[model samples]
Target chain A: MSIFEIIGAVFLLIGSIFLFLGGLGIFRMPDVYNRLQAGTKATTLGGMSLILGVGFLMVETNWAWMVKAIIIVIFIAFSNPISSHALARAMYKRKRYPIITSKDENMDAYREVNENEKKEEDA
Target chain B: MRKFLVILILAVLGFYLFEAFSGLGLGFPRFEHGVKDYYLDKTVSELHVANTVTSIVVSFRGFDTLGEVTVLFLAVSALGSVLYKRRHDVGSRSILFASSGIVRSGSKLLFPAIILLGVYIFIHGHLTPGGGFQGGAIIATGFLLMLLAYENFRVSHHVLSYVESLAGIIFVVIGLLGFIDGGTFLQNFLPSGILNELFSGGVIGIIYVMVGFKVAAELTGLIYSVLHEKD
Candidate 1:
C-alpha cells in the first residue's frame, strides 16, 4: 500500500525464499554436519529478515511492537548459533562420521592432525 | 490377525473423529446469546481489568484454577519422588557431559536476561497476553539452560520448597480473606483500582503474582530433581 509496506513485503518475500532454500539444503546435503551448517545459516538469516520486515511494517503504527520485534530478532541471532554448535558438538561426540568422497583430501589431512593430537596427549 | 484388527480399529476411530469435526461450525453463530456476552459486557466494569481472560481465570473461575494448580503440584511431587536418589549419592554423582567454555559463558550471560523477561511477562499478565504459566515456564527454561551448560549448577531444594509453599499459602489466604467482607471465595474484596494501571485489578494481580512464584519454583525444583537422578 505504502512505500514502507512495499519494502516490508519485499523483505518477507526474500526471507521466505531463504527459508525454502534452507529446507531444500537439509534434504540435499550429504550429512548431518553439512545439513546443520546450511540449515542454520539460511534459517537464521531468513528468520531475522522476516522479523525485521514485521518491525518495519509496525514502525509507524506502534513503537512498542517494533521494539519487541527487535528484541525477538536479537534473541534469535544469539540462540541460533549456540544451538547449532551444540548439535554439531553432540554429533561429533557420538562419532557420527560424515560421508566422505575420495576427492576430499582435506578430510584425510584433518584426520591426520586429530591423530597427531591424540598421540601428543597420550605421550 | 492382530495387525488387521489394529488397522480396523484405527480406521473406525479416524472416520468417527472426521465426522464429528466436520459437523461443527467454523464460525461464531449469528443468533446466539450465551455466557460469552455476560463475560464480555461485565468483565471490564465488574472486575476493573482490561483483560477479560485474567478476570475469568483469577476471579470468575478461581476455584477451577486452584484445582488445576493443585493437580500440577501433585504431578510435580510425583515426578520428584520417582526421580529421587539417596541423599549421599547425589553429592558424588558426576555429570555425563560438559559443554564447551563458549556455551557455558554465553548461557551465564543470557540466564539473568531470560529470568527478567519471564518476570516481566508474569507481572504484566493482566495487561498483556502472557501470564503466570507462560512466565513460569520461561523461567524454568532459564534454569534448564544453566543445568545443561554448567555441571556444578545447583538449586537448593529447601529454598524452592519454601518459595512454593509460601506462594501457595498466600494465594489461599487471599481467597479466605474475601469471606471477611461477605464476599464469595476469591471475590474481589479490595477496591479494583483504575483500569490498566499496574496496581489495578486488586486481588487478580496479587493472585497471579503468587501463581507465578509457585509455578516457577515448582517447575525449577522438578527439573533439578530430574536432572540430579542417578544414572
Candidate 2:
C-alpha cells in the first residue's frame, strides 16, 4: 500500500526477471564465455535489485535492518563477478574454446610479452 | 514413460496445493513469534547502528559469520593446494585470447569505477545499508579488473596470505575481547554512545572493519586460487 512497499515489490519483481534472464542466457548462449558474461552479469544485477528491495522494506519498517540487507546485495554483486572471472580465466588458460570467433590476439601478445620478460629476468 | 511420470508428479503437486488452499489446513505449522524479535528489541538501542540486521550478523550471529569466513578460507586453501600440485605435474604453456578491442577497452574503463563504488558501499555501511562483506567483495572486483585488463598480472603471493591471516587474527581478537568483557563472544562490551554517529556503536564499527578485511582477503585468495597458476 505504501510507496516504499510498492517500490520494493517492483524491485523484487525486476530482480526475479533478471535472474530468469540469466538462467535462459546460460542455456541459450553459444559458448562458455558468452554464457558466463550473460549469466553472471544478470544474476549480479538481479540479486542486487532484490536485496535492495528488501533493504528498502526493512528501512520503511525498521530502519536498523536496512544495513544488513544492503550488505547482502553488495556481497553478492562483488563475489559473483570475481568468481566468474576466475572461472573464465582458468578456462582460457586451459585452452577452452569460445563459441564464436577465432584469432585471439590478446592471448598471443600476453604470452609473448610474459615469456620474454621471464627469460630476461632469468638471465 | 518419463513424460507420464512428470505429469503425474505435477498433478499430485497441484492436488496438494488445491487441498491446502481449500481450507483443508494441511500446510506446515506457523510459529507465533520468531528468533528475530529478540534481536530486534536488543539491537536497536544497544548497537546504536541503524542496521539491526547487520548487528545481528556481525555481532549477535558472529559465530555463523566466522564459519562462513572459514569456509571461504578453506575453499581457497583447497583450490590452492590442488592447483599447486597440478602446476608441478604439468609444465605446459598454452595461450588464448579474444581479439576484441571493444571488450578490452570497456573493461579497462569500467573496472576501477566499480571497485570505487564497492569501497563506497563498505565505508558508508553503518550509516547506509551496506557492510564489510559487500564492500570487500567490491574491492576484490578491482583486482579482478586488473586481471581482465592484463592477463599476466599476479597479485603478490606473500601480501595476499598476510592480508588473509591478518584479517583472520583480527576477527578472533575482537571475538576474544567480547568474551573477556561480556562473558560472551561478540557482545557489545564497549560503550554504546549516542545514536546516528560513527563511534557511537560499541564494537560494531570494529566488527565491520574486520568483516570487510576478512571478506576482501578471502575473496582475493579465492580469485587467486582459480585464476593464478605457475607458468
Candidate 3:
C-alpha cells in the first residue's frame, strides 16, 4: 500500500472506533436527547469517514468509487442529523424531557411561538 | 411460572431455528447446483440480466411481485377509505411545523435529491443491488419528510390515484404481453441486449420502473392518509 492507502487504512480504523463509540454512546446516554445527539453525530462522522476510506482504497482501480463515496457522505451528512432532529422533536412533543434543562433553554423561542398559537386558538 | 413458560417457548423456537438453519453455512451465500444453477445460468444467457435476483423477482417470479403490489395497493386503498371520513373535519394540524427553521430548510433542500436518488435506484434496478421496492420506499420517505415539516405540503389524491392505477395497469399489461409474444406468462419476450447495460434486462427493467412508481404512489398516499386525518 502507498501513502494514500495507508492514510485510507488509518481513516478506516478511526471510522470503526468512532462507530463503536457511537453504539456505546447510544447504550450509555442518559436520555433521548443525549442519545440522539451522540448517536447521530458519531455515526454520521464514522460512516462518512469509513466510506471515504473505501473510496480512497479503490481510487487506484476506479475513480467512480470516490464519487459514490462522496455522494454517500453528503447524504449521511444531510440525513442523519435531520432524522435525529425529527425524532427528538417528536419525543419532545410527546413530553419526553432531557435529564436537565436551564429555565431559558435555547428552544424557548419555539415554545413561546407555540404557546402564543395555543393562546390564539383559545381566544 | 409465566417466566418459565416464556423461556420454554423461547427455547423451543431457538431449537427449531437452529435445526432449520443447520444446513446452510454461517455467512456466505452459496447457490449450488439444481434450480439455483438453472436460474443463474439462464438469467445471464437468455435474459442477459446482470443481477440474478432482479431477473428472478421481475421475470421468473413476476406473478409473486404482482401479488405483492396488489396487496400494497389494497392496504393503501383501505387506509384511504378509513381516513376519508375524517378528512373533512379540518382540525388544525398543529403537530406539523413544530420544528425549527433549520430542520424545515434542511428537509426542503434534501427532498429533490432524495427523489432523484430513488429514481436512479429503480431505473438501475436490473444492474444494481437495489430494486423497485427499496427505491420506491426511499421516494415515499422524501415525501414523508416534506409532509411532516410543512403544513401546505399535500400530494393530491387524484394524482396519486392516477399514477398508482396507471403503473399497476402497465405492470399487468406487460405481463399479459408475454403470453402473446412468448409461450409462458411474464416471459422475457423482448430481446435482452448485452448484459450490464442500462436497457439489457428488457421487460425486467421496464417492469421494475413501473413497480417503483406504483409503490411510491401507494406509500405516499398511505402516509398522507395517516398523517392528515383531521378529526
Candidate 4:
C-alpha cells in the first residue's frame, strides 16, 4: 500500500483505540460526571481521527465527498462537549450521584456559608 | 408488593398489545420503478449541491425544513421558559473574564474566523456537503464563543427575532406560492437553469438561505437562553 494509505490506516487504528477506551471509561467510571467527561472527550477525538482517516483514503474524484465528511466531523467536535457539559451540570444540581471524595480545603467553608445562610433565614 | 406485581404485569401486557395491534409494516423504503434513480441522477447536477441528501432535504423536502426550524424555535422557547431565573436568585456562577492569555487571545482569533466560515458554508451550501443546518450551527458557535470569552456580550434580541421571523414567514410564503402556481406544496415554481452553476436551481437556493437564517437565529436564541438561564 501507499504511504497515504499507511497513514490513513494508522489514524483509523488510533481512533478505534480511543473509541474503545471511551466505552471502557463509560462502563468503569464511578459517577455520572466523570463518565460523561471520559466518554464525550474520547469519542469526540476518536470520531475526528476516524473521519480524517477516511477522508485521506478517498481518491481525487471523491475529494469533495471527503471534504463534506470532514465538515461534519468538525461540527460534532464542537457541539458534543458543550452539550455534555450542560447535561452533567444539570445532573450535579439534581444530586444524582454521591461525592466520592474531596481533597479541597474550601469544603468546610462552603458548608459554613450554607449554615450561616440557613441561620439567617430562620432568624 | 402484590400491587406492584400487578402493575408491572399490566404494563407488560399493555406494551405487548400495543405492539401487536400497531399497523406499521416492517419494511425498508420502497421505490416506484425508476423514480428514485431519475431524481438521484438529476439532483446533484441540477441543484449544484454536492450532497444529494442535502439537496433532497432543503429543496425537495422544503416543508420538512420549515417544520425542523419551527421545532428548534419551540425548543428555544421552552428552554427559556423553564430555565428563566428569578430576579432575586443569586443565579449560576458568574463567568470571570480575567482568564489567562491563551483563552482571551485564542477566542479573539477564533471568533471571527468561525463567523466567516459559517457564512462561507451557507453561501456555498448548494455546491457543498454543508447546508443550512450546518452553517446555522456554525454561526451559533461563533455567538457562543463570544458569550464565553466575553461576559458582557449580549445578542440583540429585537434584531435577531426580526430576522428570524422574516425568514420563517418568507419560507412559508414561498411554499404557499408553490401551491398556488403548481400542484405540489413546495414545487420548484421558479425557473430551473443549467446545472452545476451558482443561482441555477429553482427555489432551492432561496429555500436554503431561508433555512440558514432561521436555523442560525433559533440556535443563537437557544444558546442565549442557556447562558442567561441564571440571569
Candidate 5:
C-alpha cells in the first residue's frame, strides 16, 4: 500500500473510533443537553474525519471528491452546531433543565427578559 | 340489490386489472421497443435535451408536470386555508423563544448560499440530475432556516401568491403556445439547439424554471402559513 492509503486507513480508523465513542457518549449521557453536546461535537468531527479519509483515498480519481468532502465538512461545521443550539434552546424554553444546576444566578436570564418585555408592553 | 351491484362492479374492475397486468412479463422490465425506447431515442436527437429525464418531464410528459404542479398548488392552498387567521384577529407573530444571536447571524450568513445553490440546481436542471422540485424544496428549506432562526422574518403572502400564480400561468401559456403552433401539447416548437448548452432545451428549460419558481413560492408560502399557526 502507498503512504497516502496508509494515512487514509489510519484516518478512517480514528474516525470510526470517534464515531463509536460518539454513539456511546449519546447513550451514556444522562440528559438531553449533555447528549446533544456529545452527539453534535463527536459526530461532527467523526463524520468530517471519515469523509476526509475517503477524500484522500479518492484523490487519484479526481480532486472533485476532495472538494465535495470539504464542502460537506464545512456544512457539518455550520449545521451541526446550529441544530444542536436550536434543540438546546427549544428544550430550555420548554423548561427541561440540566439535572444539576450550575452555580450561576443569571442562568435564568430569560425570565428577567420576558418580564421586562411584559412590563414594556404593559407600559 | 345494492350489494350485488357493488360486487359486480368490483368483479369487472378486478378482471380488467388482471387482464391489463398479466400481459406484461413480471420480472425485471425488458423495455424492448416500447414508449421507453421511443422516449430514450427521441429525447436527445429531437428535443436536444441531454437529460432524457428532463426532456420527458418538461416536453414529452409535460401535462403530467402541469397536473403535478396544480396538485402542489392545491395542497399549499389547503394548508394555508387550514392554518389561516385574519391579520386583525391575531396579535403579531414571532418565535416564542428567540434563537441565539449565533443562529440568527449564522442563518443570515448561510441563507444566500442556500438560495444560490437552489437557483443553480434549477437553472441547470436540463443538464444535471436535479430539476424544479428538488431545487424548489432546497429553496423552501433555506426559507425554513430563516423562519426558524429569526423573529420578524415573515414571507409576505401577497408577493409569494403573485409569484406562484404568475409562474403557473406562464407554464400553461407556454404549453398552449406549443399546442397551438405544433398541434401537440408542449411540443418542441422552438429550435432545439445543440444539446448540453445553457439555452439548448428551449421551452423545456423555461418550463422547468417556471416550475422551480412556482414550487419555491408555494412551499415557502406553505411553511410560512404553518409558522404562524404556533400562536
Candidate 6:
C-alpha cells in the first residue's frame, strides 16, 4: 500500500529466499561442519531480514514493536555464530573429520599436532 | 501378506481421520460471545489491567499456574536426583575442550545482555506478549551458551535452590494473604494502580515476577545438572 510497506514486502521476500537457500545448502552440503556453516550464516541473515521487514511495516503504527524487533535481531546475531562454533568444535573433538577434496592448511596443521603428540607418547 | 495388512490398516485409519476432520471448518474460527466478551469488557475495569491474558493467568487461573509451576519444579528435582553424583564421581574430566578465542570472548560479552533481555521480558509481562515462561526459557538459553563456551563454568547449586524456594514461598504467601483478607485465593487485595502502567495489575504483576524468578532458577539448575553429568 505505502512505500514502507512495499519495502517491507521486498525484505520479506528476500529473507524467505535466503531461508530456502539455507535449507538447500543443508541438504546439499557434504559434511556436518559445512552444513552447519551454511545453515547458520544463511538462516541468521534471513531471520534478521524478516524481523527488520516486519519492524518496517510496524513503524507507522507502533514503535515499540520495532524496538522489540531490533532486540531480536541483535540477539540472533550474537547467538547464532556462537552456537554453530560450539557444534563445529564438538564435532571436531569427537573425530568427525570433514571430507577433504583439496589441501587444507588447517587440517595439515592439526595432523602435525597429532603426530607430535604421538611421538611424545612413544618417547 | 504382512505388507498388505499394514497398508489396509493405514488406509482405514487415514480415511477415518480425513472424514472426521472434513466435517469441521478449516478456515478462521467463528467468533463467539462467551467468556471472551466478559474478559474483554471486565478485565480493565475490574482488574485495572490492560492485558486480559495477564489478568486471566494471574488472577482467574492463578491456581492452574501454581499447578504448572509445581509440575515444573517436580520435573527439575527428579532430573537433578537422577543425575546426581558425588564430588569424586564427577571426575575431573576437562569439560572445556580447546575452543577459539572468538567463541570464548563472544559468549562472555553476550551473556549479560541476554540475561537483561530476559529480565525485561518478565518484568513487562503485564504489558507485553512475553511472560514468565518465555523469559525464563531465554535466560536458560543464555546459561546454555555459557556452559557450551566456558570449560569450568558452574552455576552455584545453593544460589539456584535458594532463589527457587524463595520465589515459590513468596507466591504462596501472597495467595494466602488474599485468602486471609476474606477474599478468594489470589484475589487482588491491593488497589489496582492506573491501567497500562508498569505498577498496575497489582497482584498479577507481582505473581508473574515471582513466577519468572522461580522458572529461571529452576531451568538454569536443571540445565546445569544435565550438563555436568559424570562421564
Positional deviation of B143 in candidate 2, in angstroms?
A: 2.0
Clashing residue pairs in candidate 5 are none
Worst 10 residues of 3 chain B by lDDT: B86-95
TM-score sort, best first:
1, 3, 6, 5, 4, 2
Better candidate by TM-score, 2 or 4: 4
TM-score of 4: 0.61
Over A1-123, each residue of candidate 3 has an lDDT whose tens digit, in order, gives 787798789889989999999999999999988888889889988998999999988888898999999988888888788888879877866767666566657645656665677799899
lDDT for B122 in candidate 5 is 95
Candidate 4 chain A, run of 10 with poorest lDDT: A89-98
Cα error, residue A1 of model 2, in Å, equals 20
lDDT of 4 by residue, B50-102 (tens): 55766778776666877888898788778877776667875667643233334
| TM-score winner | 1
TM-score, prediction 3: 0.87
Error of 4 at A34 (Å): 9.3
lDDT tens readout by residue for model 2, A39-62: 899999998998888877667779
DockQ, in order, for the candidates? 0.56, 0.07, 0.64, 0.12, 0.55, 0.62
Docking model 5 quality class: medium
Better of 2 and 5 by DockQ: 5
In the range B141-216, model 2's lDDT, one tens digit per residue, is 7777666557666788788889888878888888898889889887777888777777667777776777787778
Per-residue lDDT of model 3, residues B119-221, tens digit only: 9999999999999998999999999989877867879999999999999999988888887888778876788899999988889999999999999999999
**DockQ for the candidate 3 complex?**
0.64
- Model 3 residue runs over 4 Å out of place are A89-123, B1-10, B13-17, B23-33, B82-97
Candidate 5 lDDT, B1-231, residue by residue in tens: 999999999999999999999987778767666798889888887888888898888877888999999999999988877777777777665545577888998898889989998999999999989999989999999999998888678788899999999999999999889889989878767887988998887798889999999999999988887777756
State in Å the error of residue B74, model 2.
Answer: 0.9
- Segments of candidate 5 deviating more than 4 angstroms: A101-123, B1-27, B30-34, B86-88, B91-95
Question: What does the i-RMS of model 4 come to?
Answer: 5.8
Q: By TM-score, is 1 or 5 better?
A: 1
Best by DockQ: 3
Between candidates 1 and 6, the DockQ winner: 6
Ranking by DockQ: 3, 6, 1, 5, 4, 2
